[model samples]
Target: MADAWLVVIDHQRIFADPASEWCAPRFAETAPVVARLATHFDDRVLLTRWLPGTNRNGSWRAYFDKWPFADRPDEDPFFDLVPTARDLTDRPTVDVTTFGKWGPELAAVTGQYPHLVLAGVATDCCVISTALAAADAGCTVTVISDACAGSSDENHAAALQVMGLYAPQITVLDSATVLA
Candidate 1:
């Protein structure tokens, strides 16, 4: 896998706020190809950031209180981070909160990259919940499907058909086969 680890889910600012309601013009058309794969894999990118508050209660405050302009502030203005991406100097932006970004700061930030090349936005919630929680933490995943973006298009084709029929740990490549 070439020391994998390029996550970028939840490309924030309320999912690129086009006035929310989970707007998705293919998430601004895959934000410039995920900002050119975070500038050609700058130390293998990682850029998650979805910090809506309200104590983030069960099921994330019942899934943002069913949107419709749900405003759970205290600081989460969509937790911005999509200004062309690539800012984490030596790759270090984690800031998690469930919805598939399963704990321990993404296992202490990719603990040494066994594989995880997922991409961004609401593909059935936090890019299918962090590619099925990094394939149940055994790692090795690759959901890139045009750099990802959902909340429509049939919830992004039913979250890539449940991460290809019930996530056998993931492998739904595209986006030029994980940026070649």
Candidate 2:
């Protein structure tokens, strides 16, 4: 597993804090599972944060318009990593404007074709976005279901099912299965 990098995605205040409209209901419960999964990655971990692009070009402009609260600058407290997850910062970290974290910024950190173990919040969104893009880019991807949270339980399962369709390129499993 040394070659595989554990990428913890968007475990931010906006998605984890109950007061936020974008909060993921299971985010609190998923944090511990993510922490435990990080231990298995050795020192190979990449923590990713989502921030609104300053430009907000193309469809992104409309995307942000629909969710105005998240349109703030990256430094906003709304984008901070969940308190309990800050301890996992011993490894490398990156801030991304895009929903998918598998572009040049990530490729530079994980290498050209990396094997990624993904865990984090909003399975129906960021987790799914990262998984497909990484897999499509020829990086082997594994998403830990229990270590991720979504807007709703149904969305989480639906996202998992969608990602599972990618099969050999992208595999979805629970934390226990991976830990075992």
Query: Pick by TM-score: which candidate is best?
Result: 2
What lDDT does model 2 reach?
A: 0.89
Each model's lDDT comes to 0.72, 0.89
lDDT over C-alpha atoms for residue 41 of model 2: 77
Error of 1 at 160 (Å): 6.5
Off by over 4 Å in 1: 9-18, 21-42, 46-114, 124-157, 164-180
Question: Distance from true position, residue 51, model 1, in Å?
Answer: 23
Candidate 2 vs. true structure, TM-score: 0.96
lDDT of 1: 0.72
Candidate 1 residue lDDT tens string, 65-87: 67636555635545667667646
lDDT of 2 at 115: 93
The TM-score values for the models, in the order shown, are 0.30, 0.96
Q: Once model 2 is optimally superposed onto the true structure by TM-score, how far is the C-alpha of residue 163 displaced, in angstroms?
A: 0.3
Instruction: Determine which window of 10 residues in candidate 2 has minimal summed lDDT.
Output: 84-93
Colliding pairs, model 2: none
Q: What is the lDDT of residue 140 in candidate 2?
A: 97
lDDT of 1 at 92: 58
